[model samples]
Target chain A: MNAPAAQSVSPAPQQGGRPSPPALRFDNVTLGYDRHPAVHHLHLDIAPGSLTAIVGPNGAGKSTLLKAAAGLIRPLDGVIQRGVPARRIAYLPQAAALDNSFPLTVYDLVAMGLWERCGLFGRIGQRHAPRIAEALRAVGLTGLERRPIGALSGGQLQRALFARLLLQDAALILLDEPFNALDAATVADLTALIHRWRDEGRTVLAALHDLELVRASFPQTLLLARELIACGPTDVVLTDANLARARRMSEAPDPHAAPCVRAA
Target chain B: MHAIYAWLIGPFVEFDFLRRALVGALALSLSGAPVGVFLMLRRMSLTGDAMAHAILPGAAIGYLLYGLSLPAMTFGGLAAGFVVALLAGAVARLTQLREDASMAAFYLLSLALGVTIVSLRGSNVDLLHVLFGSVLALDDATLILLGAVAVITLFSLAALWRPLVVECVDPGFLRSVSRAGAPTHLIFLVLLVLNLVAGFHALGTLLAVGVIVLPAVSARFWARQVTGMAGVAIIVAALSGWLGLALSYHHGLPAGPAIILVAGGIYVLSLLLGRVGGLVWRALPGRHLEA
Candidate 1:
């Protein structure tokens, strides 16, 4: 069992001609729930300022990888190293994980993005109002400030979540299927936000199923099937051969499978 | 006006016990309703009920040891509720059982244990007092305890407001950004236990959740925001306390059940005619907002 060596390890040079260090690194990491490995022992390095798409079939380790990166799950083995502080990392879970039935206005929900700054007891002072408004406007949710989040359409709710993400001002953003069930317009709008984050030198990792979107926007890609299949430039990573392998590998997993003895 | 005054104001003015009950009810509502609102929002209303029952054995033990001592019962109940909550939460986390299932199991066991403990030595009347409570018999010490609990609950809630909302709405996101999520949740459980203990002193363990949950469920119909819901729940609970106390005084009804019944009636009314999303309002709608 050979560890898949990550291609594209050469990071883009920073302002002073120094190669910027990897923004994230997985050192022989294995992620799982209850010792049933959802993600196999693998190694990968994500460069700072890169927009990477993690593509995989259903039951693939895309979400598990993202959760581990977001510090929501501890690696069952090995380690995940992050370039930024935990507070400077933002995570947007799949829409289903959020409780929209909560009695909160759009304004209040979006304002929560300031948690890293305002903290538990800090006030959302007058100076922060403009940022919230700007985030809402950026996502085209300006007038819906007072509307309860439950009333927002699915696309509109995604937009509101994006607005919240914008206010997060994070260095590393982990989005778990940000465009699932969204219309084309909302996808385009959110994709543009992703591009803007890349342009601003923020690292963005999104797990997505849409291969075309990944080919179009994501420069780097990691194709996974409970284990890394291919990782490199999107065109090189999303080849027909790799896609077939991923589909085959992602078939119903055995819950009783024994642990791997091979070292990374 | 004279009859209204006689019916409403006369009870409090004429009787010290009525006045004490009124003050105790107001304090409980002021603090307990907000906690209830959050509990309802988090979909933990039944957990609140479970915790109410979970406190019974501790209070019973306190009764057996000290015989109706406020400090003994309050401390005992708090300790019991806290342990049960922690155990249930731990079981849910470490095992496959859900929190609700674990909580239900623990509370049922605690209730039976509490009853058996009390029935070992105390009379049926003592058991009834422990279960049903006597709000009219609140003493100076009990009133002070209620006031103190209310103050602590409000201040703690204000401080925990942000993290609590974040935790309820999107806990994964909160966990990503800060360490406040788990601590906020623990503190919220502490407050819930604290309030239930305070409420048990006035309404007894069986009826304690009445004030905590009934008004919160009713407030949902009237408000569309969390703060508004909390505010409305407080108002509803306070009003029910007043009206129920008065009705109990006049009719010789059991005070605790009377108070809970008033809250239940308000819930029904709110369900039908509340301003926000009531059945009647939704059924007969005339206005549309521009998109």
Candidate 2:
């Protein structure tokens, strides 16, 4: 299929309508597990208020890259610098990563987003009630606050998770497959919330599988297959040639098989 | 009415030992029941059991060295339990062995060593008292120890409540937001060891876990929230202690095992007839959702 023409998307204004610096920068970074590199030699900058989609075939290290950005996993080599503190970065892992057996209510789960401010000892006072309500309303989960999270359907649970992200009110949001297994209506609602976040001058990096959605909504894209295949405007990065290259590279075996050299 | 009063209140009113046993059991239940609730929630019920057994060797060693000294035995049991937990955690992290398997192995080794040590010096009667406890013979020092442990456990649990809940629900999320994740987990382990140590003084290593775990599991069938479950567990534990003490006084049975058996009976009853998630509820034709 033919790739769409490149579209120029402007960055949203910061608070007081001022321009902001880059939200994140990766300088020669390598991320891995058990000393086997998953994202290798990455050099990139994610500008503040930019909505970027990361897409590629399976084993593309998309989740690994996001984890590194969130500081959940340290870089094996080089550095990943963030403009904001770790608490100001919100990460929503895949739905399956959460333990549903926990006997937490939707309200209890959503209120955890305030943990950065309230901490372990602090109580959720009346002052924070409005924000929690607003977040739940944004995600269309208002009436289900008292319901147990385990009782929620998949779509409702996704909505509740989004409500939690809303309450986090972070400057940088990283979502890994937020739309997976969600219904079309839920996807549309969440996609709208993402756009609203971008418009509010928050940086959002989503690892997505839907190329059509990326092309339609996201202005920038990072295509990867263990290594950076292409990074630029969505139209330029999602080209037929780049996609084919990513697929081939992902399927091929490493020719130089050797023990990983630890960084000094 | 007089017959009922005689069955319930006469044992405590007539005998100081029965009164002491009741107080000790209630104190243990107040703290240990909540810990047990968290244990069941975290799926660490078996770990609690193993830790109880692991304390035996240290207590036995203390018995050998000091001859039934309460302080020595308490210290030894706490040390041994902590050591086993640390070793099990380290082994799980450093090696390919799963946590459950490592804990099981360590606990079995500890139990065997404990029994061997106890058999080396103490008479069979001493061994029986050590293994099954002498709740009816609680001294002033033991009563004071149980009371102190309950107070400390309640305060610490209150302070650590939020972090502990966050860790249990979503550890990765907790780690992402704050640096307290590891400390929270460590505090929880320490609390578990503390409760186990407290429990050993009243019910012995073999039966202490029953006092903690049975009431907690029984509460699970009746309550949907953690706080409610803890409350129910405390009630069940306290009730079992009261009834068991009365039964022991009337029939002259061993107090510790009698208490545990009462808790076990409640657990079985709750499993069948509780209002929250009981077997009876599941068997109902129209029931759909879990409480």
Candidate 3:
């Protein structure tokens, strides 16, 4: 029942001629509801140390693609190859996914990432302790460790999740809409955190909604709308043509928008 | 007075059963407190009710085979409860039915199955005892089993604590973070079922739930954090259990329900007087404080 986490690790250092494995690969991946496909022929590669944002309007399968990568929903076709098993992948889902009524502290919320390493019916170890503290510190949540999670603001909760991602010590991290309900300041702080993670040789794939923020922040893009509309550099892919195509895709359901320009 | 105090405290001061009842209450409180806190959050205290009922058929089977062996029956009951919960989970996921509907259905099915199983053995008296436990009948064997289950539940809770909390509050996001949320939650419910079954021998079905429920409910008014709530719950449960025993020694009412009632009374008191969850606090005097 636990969702598979997408990690924030680099192509794990390898020996011999095994070229560094792609951080994530969706090869001809067709994903959708039972028998009905949403996103099809989705061939995409996520390079290590790269921060790729999967952006599209609502119902665009942006969340779906991330879910497929995390192995939450079985892809209708194709495989989601990771450098290692799904365990090495750390995931930070959207803040909206959390129920605030749960009675736990910020510290308790972050501690769950270490459960897999704890072994079944096993005791916690000394080595993982420092990492937990370090992760919390990295998020600037050192003193708010024991604060009840329910009491935290949206930004604090998001940071707490980032701390959990840190606990995974993963080479790659997949985050879905992690900055949806944040203030401008929080968005900036989280953006800085993402940059820091990427600078540390980690790859971060996020599903972001803010177009300007996505353009300003992430260098890579995966423009999706029930399909892989475009996949490449932000500047290249966010061109008027692709943007118009994306806008057309967005207007598909509405039917009330102006006609999109097909640039040469 | 000295002689009377000796009679009151002597059994506890010397023999082990009296000591264990208190210890058992503490253990039950440790689990029940968090369970109560979560139940409040989820509004699924009813699930606890259904789970309590579900343990019956399993415990009845264990008892029919083992002749009141606490460990034997507890393990059986725990396993049965887990199966029922799994069935409920599957039903919720596969069908359009909500989790509450699944819980209600499972509760009735398991309760009936247990009664049918008990009738197969033709021991109405035994079933009644299991239904309403006589804690005085709980021997050292039951205590040991309770202790083991308690330890396992505690360790599991601690290990999965972080993800479980996150999952409970924000399962959608919890899903993306790591595959830690829902699995941890399933495992937690399994552990909860195990604890309830373990309490079956000493606490009975009805009172076991009450014990599991009220201490934490009462403690909620006093604490905001999980750790604080757990601490207060243990204290409340231990006190109630000890007080119930004393009251029972003086008046010949049943011990388990008496213990639960004491806890319920504490809950009532908290509701009236507590600054947080109590009823009247959100009204006149509360408004006056702000003014």
Candidate 4:
């Protein structure tokens, strides 16, 4: 990795969006597991309200970096500071490892988002009810508020969690593989929600494995393989050389975008 | 008629012993339900069991020192459980071994150590109280101590309720909000040890866990949410305690085992009767035709 492509380094993205005081900024972020560095010397400012992606191959530390940003894991070295004062951040984990035996309803599941605001001893106020209802409706689960999460199909379960994200009323959302194990329709539905969030001046950072989805949805990309390969506007970052290096450093190149090259 | 009256309704009106037992049972459930819920979630009820057995040695030593004071024995036991859990947590975090493996090691070592201490320091009567418990011997001071412990456990749970449930359900989300759950988990462990120690005289180590676990487990069959489950567990626990104590008083059977057996019975019934998915519930009509 070299300039125009930094090695063991991360740089400002070429979004022309005026860095925008990044809703999230990674200043020389060196991340990993057990003190073994995974993503190195990474620096990127996610433009406020922009839907930026940390895209990469299996061992590329895609999940690792996202986990770091979510504060689930502290970086081996470096800081991840949220823009603005401490804000409401929503995180949708890699499909909940929830005990299926738990037997919670979709309404109950979505309403959990209010836990931060409502506090435990108090009841969910009448004011919060409409938000819960609106969230379910937004996720196309209008009448299914009472549906047991344990009984939901994979897609429905995904949307229910989406409803939770909606109810969180958070400015920053970090989704880890939210699209995994979903059908095409579910993906389309979630993509629409992502689009809505980006349009609303809310910051969205999603870690995705699908290159085509990343290309279509996000303007800025953070390509990685334990080090940032390239991060900028899709056109600049998705170049053939970058894709090839990404592919070579990565496991398999999607032939759909085979050349991944746009002619001049 | 007298026997029937005593067995059926003696708990509410008759002996002060019945009042104490009833109150004791209610307190036990209040403390135990939340503890059981977390243990089941963390998959660390076995650690709770380890603490229970570990407390026996401290309890035995406390008795040797102070001659069978509930406060002395229970406080010593709680101290012992707390130390063991902290050491286990520390070992798990610092060493290559994971939490479950470290807890297992702590458990076996504690149980062995407890047996040694009891054999070395305890007399026959002390041995009986240490292992089997003395639920029949209800003193006013002991009841008050148990009641106070239950109140603190309930209030702490109420104050820390949502965070604890959220932590168990989704540590990732909780962590994302910058609330790492290790400390929260330690707090839960301490509460569990206190409940185990508090309920020790009412039900012995093995039997107390049964009383604590069974109601919460049984209640899950009826609840779709954490709050609902907890509420149901409290109700079932109190009911079983009152009824079992009354039955024991009437028949002169051991009160601890009687209460535990009632809880166990509820669990078995719940297992047979639980309805998890819509498939089983919806199958009732269609299956009737098929049959």
Predict model 3's lDDT versus the native: 0.74
- Per-residue lDDT of A1-264 in model 2, one digit per residue for the tens? 122222223354346765555789887788887667888777777888899999988788999999999998999887888988888999988764566777789988899989888888998979998999999999999888888878899999888888888888899999999999888899999999999999998999999999999999898899988878888789988999999998986544465758755332
Query: Quick one: best DockQ, which candidate?
Result: 1
- Candidate 4, B1-291: lDDT as tens digits: 997776678556867767777778888888897678667656666666777877776776777678778777887788888878888889978988887788778777776776677677667666666776767676888788778878888888887776676676666656655453677777788888888888887777657776678787787777777778888888888878877887687778888888887888777777666663233454563434442
DockQ of each: 0.75, 0.63, 0.37, 0.44
For every model in order, the TM-score on chain A comes to 0.95, 0.89, 0.82, 0.85
Interface RMSD of 1: 1.3
Q: Give the per-residue lDDT digits (tens) of candidate 4, residues A1-264.
A: 332322211134446654356677777778866555677677766767777777777788888777777667787776888874443778777777765455567887788878667754567768788999998888899998777677788899889889888877778888888899788888998999998988787888888878788888777777888767887777678787887786677443334533212111
Better of 2 and 3 by lDDT: 2
lDDT of each: 0.90, 0.87, 0.74, 0.75
Models sorted by DockQ, best on top:
1, 2, 4, 3
Better of 2 and 3 by DockQ: 2
Which 10-residue window in model 3 chain B sums to the lowest lDDT? B282-291
Residue B222 displacement (Å), model 4: 2.7
Which rank order by lDDT, best down to worst?
Answer: 1, 2, 4, 3
Model 3 residue runs over 4 Å out of place are A1-21, A83-85, A110-143, A166-168, A250-264, B1-44, B59-80, B113-127, B140-148, B151-163, B166-187, B274-291
Error of 1 at A218 (Å): 1.9
Q: Is candidate 1 or candidate 4 better by TM-score?
A: 1
Candidate 2 error regions (>4 Å) = A1-20, A251-256, A259-264, B287-291
